[model samples]
Target: MSVSVDSPFVHKVWNDSELSKMVDGGVQFPMLSDQGGKIGTLYGIYDEEGGVETRGRFIIDPDGIVQGFEVLTPPVGRNVDESVRQVKAFQLVRESEGSEATPSGWQPGKKTLKPGPDLVGNVWKEWSVKDNYDK
Candidate 1:
């Protein structure tokens, strides 16, 4: 889901005029309206002076907890691929019940670090950057 200060009508126009061209059938998720920046304010992205919200992406867990988030100015576009990757990593961690941790750039089927005393200072031996990048 996406939340922005734009009204529902503006979201429709944006989908019709621009977003639709980039993704088939426009965005697949709901584009929520935050006309008064109320939701943005709660998320700390609301810019009172500009009356606009900075671009932000938040990943909330099933328990209503924010697992991760990213905020950036409008000039820099967000990375959807990276967001998806992070979501996958988070899911994997949750599935493991906190026993495993993903290394940087970790992907599905890649090596994951197990949290324990043995791994405290032996992460270098357990996993390497090449593990995340090697095919």
Candidate 2:
């Protein structure tokens, strides 16, 4: 699952408790935190003065390479199901190329393209999708 760095998304005690209940009701996820804006800063997610991360989502591989990154203002919400879909796509691509990354909202069994300095627009155009991701 993917979450914003802003409201209704956190890895705090309250969130953990709620997640635990969700888990008891059958939900599973590995939680992560941008706590104190440390990781946020490293990823350029800091609001600096407000000391709170605005809104950002990053899909990273095991090697800590960022496959995708998204930053948003609070007014806009993040796309969740699409994010999961992308993870599955990344998993597939990674397995296929032996270590490759996929673009946003990607899904399994689709065409996987390589990314590089010259392949930006192509990457976005290739993976750009329209869907109601909120459940």
Candidate 3:
């Protein structure tokens, strides 16, 4: 889902634009219009003077708790692939019963860390990389 301070009419216009058409089979996600910036302010992304939210992405759990979030300046673009990966990571951690934690630059099929007091301050001994992360 993407939320903006624009009105629904503006949202509709953008959704129908040529750039938006480049989305695979058209946009599959939700685009919410926050008419008065209330939702953006709630998410702490609304710029009062600018009256627009900087690019912000939030991963929320089923219970409506925010699990992970990223905020980017307006000039920067958000990475949809990274956001998808984060959602998967959150789901993985949620199902792991707190026994495992994803390492930095973790990807699917990569090893995960078992967090514990003994693992603290010695994580480098457990995590290793064959090469730099491609992402």
Candidate 4:
């Protein structure tokens, strides 16, 4: 991600290794070691049973309101590339004109659609392309 132009964290890991081990070694950045995940519990992002930090991104605007919040499983990679774009989009829109509701694949400099009657037709059009896709 460091090489990528548009990305959030410079580095990230999906494996469930002992985060404390990172502390033992000399990591340039300081990491909050959640032994029993007490801090994680307060944030409601800690996995007590599983004993790991759930991959998540918290995009809080200047007003301290969360514009975007995403949490994903360990197997699935979190899109840090998209998160940076989202943060920029949120800040830009908040500065220019007040709006909400970011559509899928939303990115900076791209047109963000405002949710209303107009979106219904667009959504319907997309739904029409049914290929029996499943998660």
Candidate 5:
């Protein structure tokens, strides 16, 4: 779910346009419009003076709590891929019974850290660098 200060009609127009062509199948998520900036204000992303919001992405859990959020400046575009990865990580941790933690640059099927006193000061020892993470 994506929320913005634009009207729902404006969202429809933008969704139909070529603005999001880079993403395969374009924008498929529900785009909620915060026409009065109420949601943006609630999320602390609305700029009252500018009458616009800095790009904001929030991942809320099933319990209505914010699990993660990212706010970018006007000039910088939000990383949808990173947001997706965070959502997956959050879900994985939630289902791990407090036993697993996703490491930096983690993705699905990647190695996860098992948090414990043994891993407290020897994370580097437990997690090895075997692959090109950038690839």
Candidate 6:
């Protein structure tokens, strides 16, 4: 889902003119409008002076808790792939009941760290960066 200060009509126009070309059916999720920056302000992305929300991607869990978030200036675009990866990581951790932790660049089926007191300060012996890229 996306939220911006742009009105719904602007979203429609932009989707029809720009987003459609990049995505097969435009965006698959909601593109909500936040004309007065109400929602954006809550997320701390609203630029009151600019009257626009900064580019941001937030991964909110089912409990309404923000599991992960990234905010960037308008000049830079967010990374969808990275966002997806983080979401997957968050899901995995949740499914495991916080028993597991994803290493950097972790992907599905990759080895995950078993977080515990014994593993503290010994992570280097258990996992390595190579694990992220290995088949």
What TM-score, computed on C-alpha atoms, does each candidate reach?
0.92, 0.55, 0.85, 0.54, 0.85, 0.90
* lDDT (C-alpha) at residue 43 in model 1: 96
Tens-digit lDDT track of model 3 for 27-135: 6677788877899898898888988888878889988999988888899898878888888878888889778888888876777889889998998787766532754
lDDT of each: 0.90, 0.65, 0.81, 0.57, 0.84, 0.89
Ranking by lDDT: 1, 6, 5, 3, 2, 4
By summed lDDT, the worst window of 10 consecutive residues in model 4 runs over 1-10
The segments of candidate 4 whose C-alpha lies over 4 angstroms from its true place after superposition are 1-30, 99-104, 112-135
The digit string of per-residue lDDT tens for model 6 on 9-126 reads 9999999999999989897888899999999999888999999999978889999998878889999987788888899999999999999999876888788899889998998897
lDDT of 5 by residue, 1-135 (tens): 777788889988887786477667778789898887898898899988888878888889989999988888899898778888899999999999768999887888888989987888898875655531767
Which sections of candidate 5 miss by over 4 Å? Answer: 19-26, 129-134
Error of 1 at 17 (Å): 2.6
Clashing pairs in 5: none
Whole-model lDDT, candidate 4?
0.57
Q: Rank the candidates by TM-score, best first.
A: 1, 6, 3, 5, 2, 4
Clashing pairs in 3: none
- State the lDDT of candidate 2 residue by residue for 19-105, as single tens digits: 667667434554555456777788787888887776788899988899987888767888788778877877787777744565443
**Which runs of model 1 end up more than 4 angstroms from their true locations?**
133-135
Candidate 3, residue 5: Cα displacement in angstroms equals: 1.9
Q: What is the Cα-based lDDT of residue 30 in candidate 6?
A: 87
| Candidate 5 vs. true structure, TM-score | 0.85
**Which of the predicted structures, 1 or 3, would earn the higher lDDT when compared with the native?**
1
